[model samples]
Target: MIHFEISSYNPVLLTNSPLNIGVVETTLDALGERLLVIDRRGKVITQRLVPANNKLAIIVPFEYTVNNNLMCILLDDDAEKDGELVDNVKAAVIDMKNYTPPV
Candidate 1:
């Protein structure tokens, strides 16, 4: 079983208008071989190849402005063969509030 320690910050600030916001920081605890970010509808929003280090950061593009609840799942190398019940981590609900549109 792969165990992952995931933590995240809330409401990442996007100061630059029409630009990418601050990065979303996450730690995989050096467990899974890959990380998948899924949306509410079980859709794969993004995927990251887990690195050797435990730290992983994701950048939110300017196009995404809706408040979305994403699911971060860590899969082992042999995830397809053996369905191991590893740790289940829910990523932070990204809501960009207090963002004033350009006039």
Candidate 2:
């Protein structure tokens, strides 16, 4: 079975490999309101300051591969905010699946 280790203190979690979108969906749903990501310091950093439309999501695709593509959400817990909240976001990765990105 796939396991997604979630932690509120750890802002970013990674999976060893790209998990199936279906699995990702289930994992995310099970997380409920815990998907929110905070800074490494475990502090909620306000990162938005503008207005946005109805769309409230972001997907980034690169290297001509959809499976490896990552999806994320930058949330602003305010009635007035815009753009991604930067460090205040969560990624589709688990602790076991996480890897160090090459520089």
Candidate 3:
């Protein structure tokens, strides 16, 4: 099993409408020292490898018409595995939608 230290935080999305999306942070051991961001929808929007000390942040846009929230997952270059990532992403998105963060 993969041991991932997952953390979630609120981030502001830069856009005309703007958005308050939840950002999930995790480190992929398989990809060396890379951080992964799993959005509320469990989708991988952007992934890049930087120094471990570097801060990782992401912003998601809220739908203006539907008022629906969006999510994004960050992955690194070597961590880009189509099959596993996609499956995990799908599951993550489902969890995000129904996830209720503790107060």
Candidate 2 per-residue lDDT, tens place, 1-103, comes to: 9998766575575544554221122122211222332334444322222222232222212221323322333444442444242332333332323333222
User: Model 2 segments beyond 4 Å from truth?
Assistant: 1-66, 85-103
Which pairs, if any, clash in model 3? 37-73, 37-74, 39-72, 40-71, 41-93, 43-73
Candidate 1 lDDT: 0.54
Relative to the true structure, candidate 1 reaches a TM of 0.48
lDDT of 2 at 65: 30
The residue-by-residue lDDT of candidate 1 on 1-103, one tens digit each, is: 9998769758877565453253445766455777766655666667888777756766554333344445566777855443223233333323344333222
Clashes of each: 0, 8, 6
Per-prediction TM-score: 0.48, 0.19, 0.28
TM-score of decoy 3 = 0.28
Stretches > 4 Å off in candidate 1: 1-22, 62-68, 78-103
The superposed Cα distance between candidate 3 and the true structure at residue 22, in angstroms, equals 2.9
What does the lDDT read for residue 59 in candidate 2? 22
How much is the lDDT of residue 41 in candidate 3?
59
Q: Any idea what lDDT model 3 has?
A: 0.40
Better model by TM-score, 2 or 3? 3
Question: What lDDT is reached at residue 92 by model 3?
Answer: 21
